[model samples]
Target: MTEDARWLSGLEEQARARLAAPVFEYVAQGARDGQTASRAVDTWAAVEFHPHVLRDVTDVGLETELLGSPVGVPWGVAPSTLQRAIHPDGELAMARATAQAGGVMVVSSNAGTPFSLIGETGVRWWLQAYLPADRTLAVPMLDRAVAAGASAVVLTVDTPVVGTKYPVGRVVWDVVDPALLRVNFDKGTDERPGADKALDLGPHDVDWLAEHTGLPVVVKGVLRPDDAVRCVQAGARAVWVSNHGGRQLDRAVSTAAVLREVIAAVGEQAQVYVDGGVRSGLDVVAALSLGADAVFLGRLPLYALTDGEPGVARMHREVGAQVVETMRLSGCRTLADVAALHAPSAPNHP
Candidate 1:
């Protein structure tokens, strides 16, 4: 297929056909009513870019640093759970692709394979943590990630308790391969209580993590400006604004709307990242313009997983090309230029 055909929408279509019905819905659908998830994509349409003309638009640089780490693209993969359900190669395939593209891969705590294997790809990756109530269980994983060469720690704070996902709830686990969900957990008495119960983790936990790890701690899933500020104040190296891809709560505010407010709150103190409904490079430009340091993709990466590494690579290239072209047309030759394109009067939604 042409590069144009491999954009997120097309790949999503391909994935829907390739993945099992339950698997597809788990990856694609959001919580009850699904409005939050839908808004994540639809609201961006209301953000109109006022392109400047006659600028030196020949070379648009998409390279930028996130958390002081150099990345070729301005965006990266957001954490996804149980990826082996989507594809056999799972996170490992996606890691290889991210490494090839010089993009970041935020490997989920829920990844099917061990982090060590994924780390072997040498991709610039961040380990995403779903903190459990038990510090004993969570700390070793963080320490293991450090030993495995993880660049940063992404602590997912939104999911204090697992939100209701109807489709995923109906999944027939009997058919899924046991090896697919084999995360690096102790097989015997080492139980993973965080996987099921509410973590009850809070801002103090963020501070503790900062003190514990040499790796920068990125607090993901903050929507409110107050919470974002609190995370920064608690020593979060970065705050990732997300809605758990609309998986946690329905009727939640779209990431597109909350991002600007969150950035205004703690933009200077910490790097602010966002995810949810990010489908194209133009969307990435819009996010940067609105004040996000970088954007993340949740569904797109999982969808790309159906076709394995090549598919993921093509998605990156397509989005990167979109970023370049959008920059060229909008008179932005760099990320700073895109940031300057923010218009205070831009409509929040249709």
Candidate 2:
């Protein structure tokens, strides 16, 4: 009930009440037996923060530079598709909210907005690509994203295949409603192919993506140290430790758990970021200490859009505030201090 408790508050509960059943499932999914979902949070439970009490902790600046670009916070929105499922405003609202929050918005490959429009949003943009098996298709998209003014292009290396989002697809199509559409994709016609299949049906090949695009590429959805090292060697500027919010592979380890290993592998050559079950401000601290340069949110902002863009904007503000408060309480002043806390546990959950 305290002011600092805002990040721990009930945005999800409110969103669940407002959104259609299927729409909720789209944002709030866990693959297979849901083991990964539980483990994602459990990893946080295992990470305990080692707070320093008496320091000259005065100014707390959450600002950090990412890939040489200045950002207001060490966190941003994860690339999530079908954002308009909960609000008609879709990427337009989300982009505005991200800009309003002074954070980056990694636009989805399966986005509601066209690549060009997102480019003009005047916000720092990164394109999150689900690489196609056919280099013919993948390269063109990367080219388009670069042409659209994407500063960095991230290849989502995990989702080689889309997992069974069962009850979500069925319930939404059969029960709730169809407010969402991948407008950016052409649903399989004689001439145009389904973008979903193009993005998913192919096996992953990092070489093509690396060789084709001149953009500073990143590899997202990486959990293995070897893969992280591979990505960086292949010209990636960063590695995003993620499990696709537990929507891709079930029983996969938590994003926070393997972050240190990946960071250690990439060492200082590539920056590290994470997303998956990030629920609070301290979680941000946990990620940074565990070797992440920044963190991303998957479902939290969608909950805000259920009410309106401002509602989602409010969530970003509260999360940032909680992050600052957590820093103050932990005797860490600024992101550098938070980065230095490296508690060897999930920012305090342990």
Which model scores highest in lDDT?
Answer: 1
lDDT of 1 by residue, 22-60 (tens): 788878888888889878888776778777778998777
lDDT of 2 by residue, 198-274 (tens): 44422235555656666677788888998888777777788899999888899888887788889889888989999
Off by over 4 Å in 1: 168-174, 189-199, 344-350
Estimate every model's Cα lDDT from 0 to 1.
Answer: 0.82, 0.75
- Position 278, candidate 1: lDDT: 88
Total clashing pairs for each candidate: 0, 5
Model 1 CA lDDT for position 240 = 95
Q: After superposition, how far is residue 266 of candidate 1 from its true place, in Å?
A: 0.5
Query: How does residue 210 of candidate 1 score in lDDT?
Result: 66
Quote each prediction's TM-score.
0.93, 0.88
